[model samples]
Target: PGLEVSMTMLAVDALLDEVAENRAHIGLAYNPPPHARIAYRASSAQPVVLLLRKDHPLAKRGGPASLNDLQAYPLALMPSTFGIGHVVSMAQVAANVSIRPTLVTNSLSALKRFVTAENFMTLVGEFAAYRELGSEELTTVAVAHPLFESAQARVLVKADRPLAAGPLELLKWIEERMPMFAPVKRPARRKPIR
Candidate 1:
């Protein structure tokens, strides 16, 4: 939460690049797990992934969110500064459709604030919006296909050494509270790109 984090939100591939070079105490924070392993040792974080917002047409699409259905709308997205671009890549593969976001911003808090009456859709970390999702302000959208398997969010210690004192303490805290963590999830199918 402080400067020690260096950078909190980064594109996963770039993060991997850093870890490969022994640059950062890098770990991937993902709602869905990646199939291939990277150059770092891995530990996991529980996830509370949320499919949020209602009346946003996506739910009203009635049947499942088919590729054709997804094509009809411009999505509201977190800016490329955040992982929304990565999320879109994941979604593009899963939904078998390309998405052009109507808007993008990096702020999770801002995204939450903006979704009030907009039909925008976003997949977020479970902890990120637990209160609202629990209160039924949002609902988890079920996808017909699956992408990620068991592993969820990943925590990587820098290559040469291990996570030290304070950071180690934080990791332990996360592990103890793991139940609140949501396992990485995916739609049943990784739709082929068109």
Candidate 2:
């Protein structure tokens, strides 16, 4: 496809509205609303993790932590306006505790800076933070709470409109690249003697 890619970040409602109105061809949202006018190309449920600096108090524990443990530290949570926050909020409610953030913003860079500068923690999808976690700049503790283990990321397109070359290509790319959240399978050993 020769078409150029133009990307814009829109709030979930606004993005859905645009897709419904045909103003945009496709939308990638964290938690797509259930609507008849949109088609789901691909979607996956990802585990939510608590991210913090390696030297943070929680990192030394070497085990998964519950939402109750997170309450002990200052947080730099995304506000409830974003879809990820909705998952976090549900976990907070189910755990019967509050996560009082030292800072609240939707920007990933801001969250990184906050956790780096101070002993702040944040919640993120394991896939979204994979690279950083691998780099050792941050370490994750599993949320291990039922309410949060089901958050999903979605790829949506207009139901009525046939996808053009560019949009179709993008849709296929996304569907193929959706990360496999399960362990990789290894080949079985062959018998050495007959």
Candidate 3:
């Protein structure tokens, strides 16, 4: 199999443009806008959730967290330029809840690190912290809001352009594995046995 692939990370707007303009063969994005030249091949619901250390006080609640609950914590958030941040901004306004984050950055790693090293929380798409969740270093609390219910992870391609063998193959491969990336209802925390 002679397949070559190149991956580039872009903000949601630019990522959609790359696929629509045919600069990139395929794009994976969170809640991309509708474009005449882009088609969604597949999508998975990836709701916005609260990411914090497993032992954090909120995690002890063992249930969905309300946006207002965030007011009590030191919050770290991505700027509104990112998809998750934009959704969060809209949800905050719609719910009439105000959250003042202590730190704002575009870096996911920084957000993860801040929550891990300090008593801070960040809101992000559930899939964004897939690894940390798997390792049980962090856990997610579903945000109790309607706006967050529709966030999606999508596979996109040019509307009319047919993919060549390599890109098509890669697209098929990604489609088959999409469900693995979808959000799972995290189980309640279990106490450690000594």
Candidate 4:
């Protein structure tokens, strides 16, 4: 229990490089591109969703939003430096749909603030707005695009590197707790046999 751990937050590209070079013990990445030196310890589907205020017109519809639906709103987005932006760009190209964002920034807080303070919308992974979703102010609408359906959030480490005791233990701990961080739908329980 005396392990000293240091954490650094990096963009997806830098995070991959750090783990591949053994400069970091672990990295959490979203929709990371394949790298020969990296090994995925665990992964979960992390679909891109439309983040907007609860009172947004799309939110009032109470259904999945489409790329075309985004055209009506002023869109705020993260720059392509982050994985969410990168994936969104790729998906847009693959789907042959282009959206011009009104504001682009790397700050998550700024994105959240924009959506709440104005009628603007942003695209991000649902986990990014998990806390806000629990409150009444923010909500996410699932995006109805095939390319966005398969994005993954991954836990990664250097391939062939044996982790030391503390790091290994920490890795295990993270794996065990991953589900708590990422939402998963569990089947409803049935009544026990009568």
What does each candidate score in C-alpha RMSD?
10.7, 3.2, 7.5, 2.9
Error of 1 at 98 (Å): 2.0
TM-score of each: 0.61, 0.83, 0.84, 0.88
Model 2 C-alpha lDDT per residue in residues 18-121, reported as the tens digit of each score? 89899998888876557789887777787778889999888887788877787788988777766767777776777677877778887877887787778988
Q: Highest TM-score: which candidate? A: 4
Ranking by TM-score: 4, 3, 2, 1
Q: On lDDT, who's better, 1 or 2? A: 2
Q: Clashing residue pairs in candidate 2, if any?
A: none
TM-score winner between candidates 3 and 4: 4
Tens digits of per-residue lDDT for model 4, 1-194: 89999998788888999998889999988888888999998888888899999899999999898888877899998878778877778877887888789999878899999998999999888888898888889999988887667788898999999999999998998887777334466899999998
lDDT of each: 0.54, 0.78, 0.86, 0.86
Show the lowest summed lDDT stretch of 10 residues, model 1. 142-151
Better model by TM-score: candidate 1 vs candidate 2: 2
The list of candidate 1 runs beyond 4 A from truth reads: 1-28, 31-52, 60-64, 79-84, 90-96, 148-151, 178-194
Cα lDDT over the full model 3: 0.86
The deviation in Å at residue 7 for candidate 3 is: 0.5
Clashing residue pairs, backbone N/CA/C < 3 A, model 3: none
